[model samples]
Target: MSDIATITAAPIGSFTAEVFAAHLASLGDAPAWWLERKRAAYATFASLPLPTRTNEGWRFSNLSGLQLAGFKVERVDPNGQLLASPFGPAQLNFINNTTVGDGAGARAELAARGVLVTTLSAALQSHPDLIREHFMAQPQKLGSEKFAALHAAFVSDGAFIYVPRGVEVPAPIVITHAASGSGTAVFPHTLVIAEENSKATVVDHFVSVSDIPHSALRTPQFACGANDLYAGHGAQLTYLAAQNWSRDTLSFQFNSTVVRRDARVQSLNLHLGGRQARHESHSQLQAPGAFSEMLALTVADGEQEFDQRTLQIHQAPNTKSDLLYKNALRDRTRTIFSGLIVVDSDAQKTDAYQSNRNLMLSDDAEASSLPGLEIQANDVRCTHGATSSRLDPGQEFYLQSRGIPKAAADELLTFGFFEEVLSRLASEPLHDALHQLIKTKFKQ
Candidate 1:
């Protein structure tokens, strides 16, 4: 193991050199390789500067709202409080970077079938090879490299899931990450690996818990999270992430997906919280017959700002990828959607589509879209577009005339607008769960 003294001392944001040392000390008897990786990641994070206005990757972003100071990493007790999930007993709950519950009995059947569901700390000691192979394996191409490195440096424990070849899991594994207390910072991660011909579903819930009343002062928090999903040849994987942090929190999430030959992967993200939140997703089609479907829905209200960026890369011939993102902006909120699709020279017969749609509910709201395509292959069929529109007065009036109040009418219209993306889900239960969550946000 590398000596802690060998690492140079430096501070970035509220994460100081002392903080990093304390975090390392907390991980008693961790593998040497993992400890060394954290040291290097911290070095990289300190050397890199925060994103500025001149950075093209952060265009139209509220750069001033990207504050990382005044936060500390600490263990928070949830006072016997646990948020309920809509799905099965296969659930893991974490509060303030500490694991509070693990549904072992609920997962016994799947475990007997060669499925692995455990914390990253446990996986580091047992399945070291798998952890080393797929943990943040992809490069940070979406321009949050600094924050991504910081996450790698400070991440303590997260969920790890592995499915062996030809095994099928019937229930969706749920992982919940909650941040409690003011000025608290938490790093949450989930890594999923589905072997050849295997099948599985995983859902992640990001939320906040506080004693503060909703109408009173809201808690301030910081959350930096990332996830990696890999589907082996002919495998099937479905992943969903629901983020509902405190309204005064600042959040960042990065996602990377890899699909192998004849494999299929689908991911849906629902964003409904945070004073300012940014999400980046990248999907790579690495083999022939591979397919990826990426979908997201965001509800930006008040002065909230939701920034989303995505990339679809076609690395092999005969690969397909589809991405659709929808955002509903109300009050004086803002949203930015920037996406690009890249087709390699050898990736002929590639079929790719990208679209971003925004529904404006207030005249003061702002929506910005930047969609681009870069194709080195001449035979590829790729399209990209973005549109921003408001609710039609006729439609709103028609619903109101039928005895529905204006607020109820608007809620109904918004659900109608979001159905296109929700209807694509293969599981009706998951779809309804997400629908109910979004409806709760509307009511708030």
Candidate 2:
């Protein structure tokens, strides 16, 4: 059975040279170095073994559901149109895996303030030094090395934002990564660098272009993605990611965040779709007073399963980190949240917290939470917890007594449960937009 799963996921025909060659041929005037990197990445992709049940990081995940057979990396659907962002802020729209149009609109002032918000490929040429310094510099220390290798092998078109020293952008630089056709594989990458004393927001949106049409036969939406964020001394960066793939998609996204002296970084990942999805996040607080806030929200139903693994490393004195991940499970859906915090021996006064909470909406649903901490600093303040719970029957009844439908009542309570986390977003517009997005997701 495991071999069969591997056959479905590590398909033979999909990783062929002809397919990769065609992808490279389409990239007009690509740099030689990047091409070489991709070539090396492809070799790594082929050599790496498929993650099996024996892998400790993949524990509690349904390995058989990870199927990549019949998938191919192809050109975007030429005939398909991309959907607009539902609630408008600053928008960058990608149609058929290509960023078709983008507009800061009223937020154009951000560009005037010495902020460079452009596609990663564009940024590579325009701001080579910064991209060279930060892009994928962190090693894949997490257990998703295979997926990271695959992402490196195929990644194209993603956003790269650089905020100069002491410049603060009022608006979020939004990036949308849309996968259009079935059996179509895309690699989306994002790199964010906030210089010292700068403040900015970056949002990455991954969605299936339901309005698009596929021109080819036997295609699927199979994608691998990665995002790297660097916060310089005293800089503040906030990142929001909303991932919604098609039901038939197999997806993996790896996120690496590095925080420097006195810098602060807050990131939230929201997962709403995909048949099988795995997200790995790693944060390293590398200097004194650096802080990181990691948050995620997932809605799983219809046999969907989300596996998340996270690590918070405190490498310097007085650094801090707090992680809060909440999952609401319905039907036979399952979710796994495993997180750890490690404090170095010299990192005295380190403060870390990790919490995973689950709200069960169906009797058959399952949610697993594992929170651990390795504190070598005896003087540090560290805490970790996991709570698996159900909707409060009283709370449900209270809403129902107001003539609310049971489903709506449950949803309302679920929203209340998530509101605590959403409230963490300091941006009012962003908070409201994400809240409305979740509400719309529930309606669907």
Candidate 3:
């Protein structure tokens, strides 16, 4: 076989040319434009090489354990369970890339108000032009271009939401991406387009179905997902993603947000599971008065590795952005956070802030942070910092003096450390849910 043929003939990690072809064929009668795009994307994915330890972007990442060969692309018939609590106004549940839950009522209600909440495939058939215009429109500024290409080439199904101008979605839209079956690979996508003066909130949940023990050999799943948010002039958009994949799963999530003139966006990511997980987020202030608030919380335990990278770009004058990330590390877990803020020459009066804090609960746990800035404008107000500290001994002692057990007291202190980032969410329900999730992680 030739070089290209050999690479495409067999499984390369979890993706091969044969698998890509099968995925495309499964789409049966998709739009020609989209099909062509997938073909091109596959070509790109096959040609580019994976990240290496020497790459600056992949620094501090667990490059040794990154494997992609044993997974297969197939439909998984998972016994999926919907969230116990009320998710939101609209909830779409998926089992291995297939929407399995009923969202008819929510869809009907939104349809009456000119909102579109449905599967990406349906959107392509009904609104091809809109999908074509904004699908993966933002540049993948962070690393993981190769994986992004792989996602575009093999993505089978996901959620599509659109809010027309002047409409405000009273309740948030929810999408659940669940994976099951041993050695299964899934690609979940979420695309949101908010028109001028429109407002909406979207929450994405990533999970894996199966009661397998948290062992390296018992469970292994591959997840590559991406989300795009486009806020038109004066629009308001809020997005949240909570990932709790299987402990033996390899997961990747890429996010891009574009804020237009006078528009604002707030995004929060809660990380709780995965053996080796990497998340990349990029936010762009495209026009003046644009503002973006970025927040993230993570609970790293056992031998898990959580790698997060972010970029904030002030492309226009008078734009602003704020970012706060907090992580609690226990056992031998490892976490990495690298963020950068860039201001263009004309982006004067750009007010930006970035901070990452880690609370170490174990002496062996590892945490690394790289926060930087690039400014071509002299009149910009930008500040960035990263901090890693252990639990305050004095506070722990004080709690113990009050009759609280040492273990419970430590957990309380961790919650207090995370409350700073959790309090930024305007939705009380979301805040509470996240708190409960973190609390559960500690109990485990």
Q: Supply candidate 2's per-residue lDDT for 332.
A: 96
Tell me, what's the RMSD of every candidate?
4.6, 2.7, 3.2
Model 2 vs. true fold: TM: 0.93
Q: For model 1, how does the per-residue alpha-carbon lDDT over 371-417 read when each residue is reduced to its tens digit? A: 98999998999988999999998999999999999999999999999
In model 3, where is the ten-residue run with the lowest total lDDT? 1-10
Q: Which regions in candidate 3 have their CA more than 4 angstroms from the true location?
A: 1-11, 78-90, 211-218
Q: Using TM-score as the measure, name the better of candidate 1 and candidate 3.
A: 1
Identify the superior model by TM-score, candidate 2 or candidate 3: 3
Total clashing pairs for each candidate: 0, 6, 3
Give the Å error, residue 319, model 3. Answer: 0.4
Residue-wise C-alpha lDDT for candidate 2, range 1-444, written one tens digit per residue: 656564645543376667767777776666777778778877877776666778888789886666556777776554445556643543565554466764655335666777777777777678777766787778876577867877776776777787999998876778878777667777888898999999988888887765425322113477688999999999999999998787667789899999999999999999987878889999999999999999999988787889899999999999999999999898999899889898999999999999999999999998887777888887898889999899988988899999999999998898899988999998888888788777866776
Candidate lDDT values, in order: 0.90, 0.81, 0.87
The residue-level lDDT of candidate 3 at 193 comes to 93
User: What are the models' TM-scores?
Assistant: 0.96, 0.93, 0.95
The true-versus-predicted C-alpha distance at residue 122 of model 3, in Å, is 0.6
C-alpha positional error of residue 55 in candidate 2 after TM-score superposition, expressed in Å = 0.7
Report the C-alpha lDDT of model 3 over 1-444, residue by residue, as the tens digit.
143344344325667777788888899879989999999989888887767655899889987556677888888665655444334533677878888878888788999999999999889899999888888877787788888888888887889999999999978888888887788888999999999999999999887776454432337889999999999999999998998887888899999999999999999999988999999999999999999999999999899999999999999999999999999999999999999999999999999999999999999999999998999999999999999999999999999999999999999999999999888888899888788877778777
